[model samples]
Target: MSRVVLRRCIVRGRIQPARTSDVRAPGPRATAPNSRDGATPRHSASHDNRSRTEVPMVSSSVGGVKSPRFFYGWVIIACVWVANFVTVSINPLVFAFFLDSMSVDLDVKRSTLVWGITIRMISGGLFAPYLGRIVDRHGTRWPGAVAGLVVGLVLIGFAFTSNIWIMFGLFFISGLTGFSIFGGNMLTMVPPASWFVAKRGRALSIATSGQLFGTATFAIAAALLIEAFGWRWAWAIFGIVAIVGVVPPYALLMRRRPEDMGLLPDGATSLPVVEVTSAVASPTPTAPVASATHREEPDFTVAEAWRTPVLWANLAATTLLMVAISPFLLFRNHYWTTLGFSPTLIAIGVALDPFSFAIANIAMGFFAERVPIRFTGVIGGVWRGFGMLPLTLGMTWPGSVVLHNVVWGIGSGTTSVFQTMMIPDYFGRTNQGAIRGSITPIMVTVSALGAPLGGYLLDAGVSYIAFFWGIFLAVTVASASFFFQKPPKHAPAATDPPTRMPTST
Candidate 1:
């Protein structure tokens, strides 16, 4: 500076790190510019400095080199995945594995225990709407955390209790407290609907895949635990795992939606606006048909969605399928044993369902956006119905046993994904939790009867064939009805323009 030399400087949006030896004194042209007023012109000096530097500025949308490194949506998905894996692994799903031990130790009938499940379903149905509304307004974090903690405490209490009344009370509390599979489903599914638009299907599939894996892992682990330790210790262990695993992740990582993180759905910078054209009939045969375009989707309110046939149809169809599958699933171990299969064979066959299911879920994540979700549902349901037919034929054939488990598991996995995705697809994300919650009571009411009905058949000396055949018929009819299903058209309107509905979620 004392020598009036130019050294290292920031020039043209880049750093020019000049060596000390390379520094040069300003020339006459750099120091001065020809001007009538006898002063250096500001534009001439700036132009001279610019001519000395050659680096170009990198253009960016926000004047930065790059955007943020991660999407918060994936963090939400990972949290949901962990929560679902832990919650599903501990209660209700793994409970079935320990049922026989619980029945023997507590001197309670298996049917009585089955009724406890029905109570769980009933309680869950009753509380679903209120809980869903809570999710809608407040977000899933508080409800998931608090309910998960309560469920864990109840499970730990379940380990020490021998009274059926106490057990019933615990089951009720667990249902209300979000330990049930129903609660896990609600918790895992609702937030993703708000977080993603384009990637919703993939996100749901990935999250639910954890449920499938948990089903397999926990069922096997329960069996091992019951054999090594007692069922009480096993229950206590599961309760501990749930508390340590599920609550913290959901509380720490879950936000209501991408908007809460200052991000758009699917990490998009802008929302997608779809345009549709309505056809108007011509006055003359030769005249060209008039067409009108519109910009809105059928984002129905809870009342409006309930009024639509599409919602009701989907509900009815889903209810029938659940009714068919629930009993078979609850009684699968007993059914397989009655068929004279060895315990090892039975275990292998049972494991196949969740493994196949997990694989199918992963596949659906990639392809769900491409196909019509309704068609996927119908096809999967039909395939599952077909898979159930092997049970109708006496279980003497191992080939049939293997076939049924693998095929039915795959179908069930895909259908479950569609069912979850369809709600947000048919209804907008704004009221998804509540809308699904409103329909849940009816579905669970029908499903609650399934286990009890199966138990009654078993107690009454009805063969597994009779119960399974009845299921096959119900599933067949329900799946068939879906073939005719379509989104209902909006009534002709003056101010609003009619549009074709989107095909997938």
Candidate 2:
């Protein structure tokens, strides 16, 4: 018989690798369920398994060993990391240097341009749930690849769009299409899921730092790029960077898991074989809370992931609270200028954005790794609500817009990071793309609603006071995603005691 190169497949959480090397050498305990088996997993990130059978199998290649996703997986993470850095950078970059020129030449109101910004925000934010669902079912490789490709294309397409409607369509496409970040939850969880059991916190925190580093470095560069090139050229250049930068690494380096290569989780032999395999075998969740778990360990199935009362509460809270900020951000110049700060001061304040966001995102990343994921959302609520102090006071105090912007920026930064990170914590890694993507349209709706609402308020001679108050109010209430989330029957506890990944992507 030709020697086959299949890797071990788990049966009821036990990893029984029928290796040609070890198949005949093991003692009786090696073949049995040895509680003392020295190959336990370091950490097991939550996964949805409602439709998955007990065994989690990875098909072997012609060469025999199942391909470890890590060999090529890091490549995807690097690519997405660069692209996201470039894509996200475009927002603040364009606003700082090109907003006035673009607005005037396009013959649109500044608030209209706000539509472009908000459209993307809503698209990305709303679809987060759907994206999570996709990752849960299909695994992470293809979705990340596809989303990177489509985002690159959409951004490139955006450069040539001459019509406002076309711009809207393309930008919206970039935003909505890339809703696959939740699919990357596996990326976030890998540190905890695949590394030292003792160092899960530190590992996850370090990995999360990539987001802030990417955001900050790219954002600052975007400012300079916009200053040098016209906005159109900036778009073209940045789009190219996103596409060219992300696709190759993703194709060449990224993998879905260490198990794909026949190695045990974390490549460690310290854990029992059965425990290690079971930890790696379970699929991540992408559903309502009630259906999220196979049982009580903060893990759940996609079917029950979001259906719990917790989902509804957080859903409402997250959506409303998040919606308030983007419109304001899109029109920051106009809104803040009205408070009568000079251009220099506004410039100074706007420059603070990357720094504030960098700080907040970095902090949240560490928090995600160390803190209870639920508290991240709650923190967002408190931060954002209180951060609006500037908006409320700026009109009365000279140069108060800066203070307001500072507070709001920090709050927005924290809230954004918390929600962005929560998909993995809540839904696990199952069907992540679908779960995240489905919500994209709601963000669109919010953007559509926000633009006109802000405009109407201004046109009706309403004060910024109302606007700031409204923003703060939403933030105050937005903590519900955390407060209201409930676990399925299988979860270890309904409390938020649970906690939890990696790379630039």
Candidate 3:
């Protein structure tokens, strides 16, 4: 008779067996029990005339031991921070400074100039659903890298274009490519949501604080460049920075999820394991199993999320707030100039807005970890509404200018973090991009109206003060809407376990 020895090892979440050479044995061959009975085989040295032996089962490093190295998720966060800092600046942040200069150079109304942004928004909104699906399926690296390259080139195009139509066309292209790919919530916000579950609030806040930091830093930089070399050259300089800052980091460093690297979310060091029973009178190997804890996260698909009332309520609130705020933001510099502030002072003021925003964003991020995000949204909306009151006071007290921005910045920063975290927190990460993208058209359509409407109203002799008051009213309503939002429930199939709703916090 011949005896066979078998060894089992765990590799990449699976159990596989390795066979060793057969050995000669006396009498009847010893047989092992079936694995399904959950019984261990026994051997007697006297009966079988064979020596007892112990076999070691090999386990994957991810399952066997914890690594002490720094988590790669933080690295992803840093890369996203850099990407956001550069990419977001080129559009609304630094681009705001270029509006007056571009209007003058292109011989167009400021209203006409801002239509470029409106067009960009519409086009980006149209493209968002597809981009979301791509991010969900393929990951962020290629899409982000391509977007950075296109946006950089578009900025360069803006530097040389004298035709307003051509400029609008360029804006349209940017919307389809750059903004759709890496700008706003897609690249900057989504990755952090997928990478960390427990630390999501802080992670997203830190990642997105780049927007405020970039706004503050680049507002000053854009001002100096516009003053020194004129707006065309300033745009040219920004284009170069965009290419350098955005392209390399995303291409080399960005990953879709922590699982791709054989790591768990929130820097969890050990992989979950299930014991395997073998019949060969040898040690059994353990195989990696999906974490039961992680599966509890709510994974509402796009269609399912759309059916929930909370989604609609949140979207409605978001839409109203954006519609109210967008025009004010578009016309802020122009309105301040009318109040007799110097360009230098206006530049300093603009820088101050986001500096305050950065401070509040980090602070609120910590607060969000312990509180339900809806409450933060409510507080932010009410605070921002009051912040508008200071603006209605006009330059009557120049100090009011400082007060309005600081208050508005803190409110906006708090609200921004709330908005970014809400969707992922309510819906699981698996299909979040698609769920978020589905709402883009509604948000973009209403928000896009702001710039053009503000331009038209100003041309028709409506006072900026009236617009400020209207925003205050709109924000109040939106704040009240936040009280109605709640986490949505999903109907699971018969075979699926009942889904657990995340704690309200």
Candidate 4:
């Protein structure tokens, strides 16, 4: 019996080895650190359980993007687009509406009213970078929702401001609301770039239309509102309408990116939705990995974008334009009062500025592909050169004001719309947010100073009509600057038929 038991033990020992290994376990990483202790790790049981990393495959959305089937990205664009329209439309337009009331109620110098606009410009440009990084990490929906709340609350607060300082504070906050949410536009571009490589130009143009259309329509509507109700009530109306209109679409429509959905980008026929993971929310150097999906579009690094000569040239262009545009926005109260227009009519005119831009943007959208962007700049310069001349002469002559605006509106719209193309054109695909964000500060500062400068020039007994001519010359300098630089070597080319759009969510 003892011999038989020993034999059984011997048999059991033979059946099992000292250690076991599973083929499924991953091989060691090339760069993994070895412990100082220098013993090979005893593999954990769960180590082999999960797969390494997955690259999903998906070309088209589960359902093709039809009218009812807006791709998640497209939906986000539409929603953000409307919000953008309302934001820009209400900002400058509403200021023109409420200035006289604010002047009377607060008893401040109306020329100083540009101080409010100047403050907003400075604040908005400053906050852009911080907001941009958060979007890069998280997503657009939250930021947009938060911006709406801020805009609404500040607008409501405007109703009660008895002090100029308090009103100044609120207007600055309104700018934060306006420019901070621009991150949404960048967010939209990145994902759509992932989903629709073939039709990117058209998709971008469509997305851009919202901003254009909204500016015009919102301007007109804002004027009508200011006309019917006092500025106080206009604030209330703007706040209420934003909450009702904006909140829903953001929640339902916006997404982080297609990679989050485990799908390929741009829905290439061969590569499917691979997943925009937290890992992909960003990537580190050395690896330089990108998905076979949408991220393949030519992208630039922030450093590269800043280094480009064209970008610097464009910066020069933006500076001249900023100076030219600031006079109307910063000095609207002074502009109207000197002309003897009623506060009501000034409000009405403010509305026209954005409305004109909206129409101009749509028309310019067609020309974007057809014309060289450089030509647009030259045309805009010529218009800006002359756009404000009539208004500078004084508000007493409404015809000059109207004519100035006709050119002003067209030139302003053209210049702004053209500026919109800068991202895809020079920065290409990568780091556009950072590059664009970087420019805001310079632009805003020019605007900030330009406002007071306009007022100061008027105070100095300089003819604003002469100032307008100088501004036109500045535009010429800016337009000419574009010639100093060459196009980025790998800049994205305009597509022939345009790329296909991502499927609707």
Instruction: Report the number of the highest-TM-score candidate.
Output: 3
Summarize candidate 2's per-residue lDDT along 416-471 as a digit string, tens digits. 55565444344543333454444445544554466556766665777767777776
Q: Each model's TM-score, in the order given?
A: 0.78, 0.67, 0.81, 0.69
Candidate ordering by lDDT (highest first): 3, 1, 4, 2
Pick out the ten consecutive residues of candidate 3 with the lowest summed lDDT.
Answer: 35-44
Tens-digit per-residue lDDT, 86-181, candidate 4: 555345444555656667767776568768777887887787666555655676677767777777677678767678888889878877754322
Global lDDT of each candidate: 0.66, 0.49, 0.70, 0.53
Model 2: residues >4 Å from true position, as ranges? 1-80, 90-97, 118-134, 137-146, 179-228, 263-299, 339-348, 367-371, 395-410, 413-417, 437-448, 484-505
Model 3 scores a TM of 0.81
User: What is the number of backbone collisions in each predicted candidate, taken in the order shown?
Assistant: 0, 95, 0, 36
- Residue 158 accuracy (lDDT) in model 1: 80
lDDT of 3 by residue, 369-403 (tens): 66677777887887787778877755555666677
Q: Is candidate 3 or candidate 4 better by lDDT?
A: 3
**Model 2: which ten-residue window has the lowest total lDDT?**
287-296
Could you say which candidate leads in lDDT? Answer: 3
Model 1 residue 269 lDDT score: 41
- Cα displacement (Å) at residue 278, model 4: 34
